[model samples]
Structures are given as C-alpha cells and as structure tokens.
Target: MQDKIYFIELNEDKKYEDYKQYHSLLPLEKQQKIHKFRYDIDKKLSLIADLFIRFLICQNLKLNNKEITFEKNPFGKPYLLGNPEFHFNISHTRNAIAIGISGNPIGVDIEKIKCADLKIAKRFFSSNELEYILTNKEDSFFYEIWTKKEAYIKWDGRGLSIPLDSFDVTGGPIDKMLRMVTIHGYIISVCSRQDFNGAWCMELAEDSVPVCLQKIL
Candidate 1:
C-alpha cells in the first residue's frame, strides 16, 4: 500500500484575477459555494484552499468527481464514504494546507504562528511541557510545541474537546502510536493505526496556484 503525505502552501493574498482563474477551474458546486460567499474573503480563501486539495487528490488518484463523497464525523472530522481501504486527513492554516494519505488511518494539522501568548499554554500543555517551554525562552519554539499537541489531538478524532494536557509527546521517532515534530515554523504531528517509522515528508511551495479537483479514495 502507498503511504504518502503531501503538503501544499498557498499565499492567501491572491489577486482578483488569480482568484478568477482559479475559480473558473473549480467544480460547479464549489463555484456556487464560492459565489455564495463573495463578500466574505476569509470564507472564500478557505473554499479555494479546499478545492485545491481536492484537485490534487483527484489528479493523484485518477478518480472522477462523481465518485467522491464526503461525510463528517459527529465531531465534524471529514472522511470518505464507501471507501475504507484508503485513509486521509487534512489541515490548513491561514497560509498553508496539508494532506496526509496512507493505507493506515492518519491525521494532519497546520497552524500559522501569530501573536498568541505563551501564558495560555498551561491550559493545554502538561506541567512538564510548560516547564520545558519556560526553560526554552522562545516564543516560536513554544508555538511549535502547541501546534504539535493540537495536531495530535485532532488526529485522535476527539478534537480539542479532549483535555489538551492529557498526554505528552517526547521528541523522538514516532512509534506505533503518536509522534510530533517541528517543521519550518510549523508544528506537525501525526497519529496512525500503526507505527510510522521512517516516514518522509514533502513540502510544497507556498505560492503554488490552486487547481480544481476532488477525489473519492
């Protein structure tokens, strides 16, 4: 089975012309959704990003648009319908998008580093994690830690509804359970059905243009 994950980044500040070109390629339903939110730029950008990911998935899997069906968990985690052989997860930050695809269940998350204060880390991070962050004295490092934890929680399919401090991730090769890593100003974490030893990552360019597409598996 193929075990590959793709990371795509896009500048959220695309010009109207760029958006028009991207929008024209989107599926009809997606186009309607975009038009419906014409006045909401944030919602428009998010739709565009999602369309891009769908496009990539379609191209890679060679699947037709009609074959894809999306169903969300009770907690709102999106999943494929009628296809259980392949597993995937998606996460997008303000300026980037990430997609994790594998034969085993997988989850991915991306977050943009902003001005969030470390004071709130106590609410989510364990006491040991808080102490480590304090000793590090780096806001960027702290964000990395925060994102990793958040990603793991999402991967668990419980969302932030689960207490954030319930678990700790020691830096190491991710085993059969949970693993965390800091990559390029982003905290990335993955949870899988089995150990993810020797997994490699591909980072796409941030300014890559969006493509129109969708996939079922």
Candidate 2:
C-alpha cells in the first residue's frame, strides 16, 4: 500500500460561501467546530480541513464518506478509529491543508514561510537545530526545521510533553523516514515509519476541495 499526501489550498481572498457544497457532507461535530471560529478564514479552513481529510479517507480506504470515524490518542493526535490499518494526520496553515496517509503511523505539517522571531528557535530547538536555522538566515530554512519538528512530534503521538530540545532532529533515527517538500510558498514536512523516498505531490484543491474530489480519486 502506498502512502499518500493530499493538498488543499484556501487562499485569503476566497470566501467560505464558495465552498458551501462541502458543508452538507461534514458531520455535526465538524460543522460545529467550523462555526466555532470567529473569523471567516478560520471557519473556511476548519470546514475545508475536516471535509478534505474525510474525503481522502473515503477514497483511500474505499469506504463511504459517512463511514469514516476518528479517535484521538491521549495526547490529542487523531487516528482512524474504525479502520486502524489506515493511519492519517492533518495540518492546516494560513493557506493550505495537508493530509498524510499510510498503513503505518504517520504525521504531516505545512507552514507558510514567513519572518518570525528567531529567539523561538533558541528556546525549543536543539543546539544543532538552532545552529542550522541561525546559520542559514533564510525563512524557508527556519520553516523547514520547524515543520520537521512539528511533524515528528505528531508522529510520536505525544504532544508537547516531549520537549523539543531533548531530541536530535538534524540526524533522525534510521528506521523512520523524514521528508520535506515545497507547496506554493509553504514548507511541508512529514514523518512516518514506512520507507518514503520523498515522492509526494501538492496540487491546489481550490474549487475542487468539496465538489471535484470524487473525480480526483
């Protein structure tokens, strides 16, 4: 079984009404979460994220959209509760939602490259990690390390309890795969137990997010 990652882009200027077709497919819980957001963009992101992940699960597992159910680990990492053989994780940044799927444990993160405080690097990153980010002075470099660390923590399934500085991300363990890719202006990263050769693609879900995903699958 091949591991796959799906991409959905929701740009800032886009309105939530444009994707209203997806709302009916989202469960009550997801609908409530989307409505909980005070901002329109947040609402759309939440809405698109929930439906897109469910759509991916249905296609990959060959199950009906309504058949998908999820459970969270103690640390709040979500997994496929009904179909344990299919592991998945989702991350959403300002403009995109990334979903990772595999037969084994997996995590994926995507972040738009932007200027932020470098001091954050000093606080949570390992010395080597800090050095790498500091040495490059590139926004992409900082985001690459940040996304990698974020993905690793999600894969480990033990959220913030695992101190960021405690592990060496520069040279990750051999058994699992660590990979990074670029989508639009974002730095996307993923970690999984399976052997991934870093062959993942990103295409804008744009208008296709809710309507055309069946054709996509």
TM-score winner: 2
lDDT for each residue of candidate 1 in 60-91, tens digit (9 for 90 to 100): 56666456677778877777677676677787
lDDT of 2 by residue, 109-166 (tens): 8999889578889898889888888888787888888888888888889967999888
Please report, in order, the local distance difference test score of every candidate based on alpha carbons. Answer: 0.63, 0.79
Clash pairs detected, candidate 1: 54-213, 55-213, 176-195
Q: Which model scores highest in lDDT?
A: 2
Candidate 1 root-mean-square deviation in Å: 4.0
Task: Name the regions of candidate 2 deviating beyond 4 angstroms.
Answer: 174-176, 213-217
Task: Give per-model CA RMSD.
Answer: 4.0, 2.3
In model 1, the runs with Cα more than 4 Å from the true position are 16-41, 114-116, 171-184, 193-199, 206-217
Instruction: Provide TM-scores for the models.
Output: 0.75, 0.91
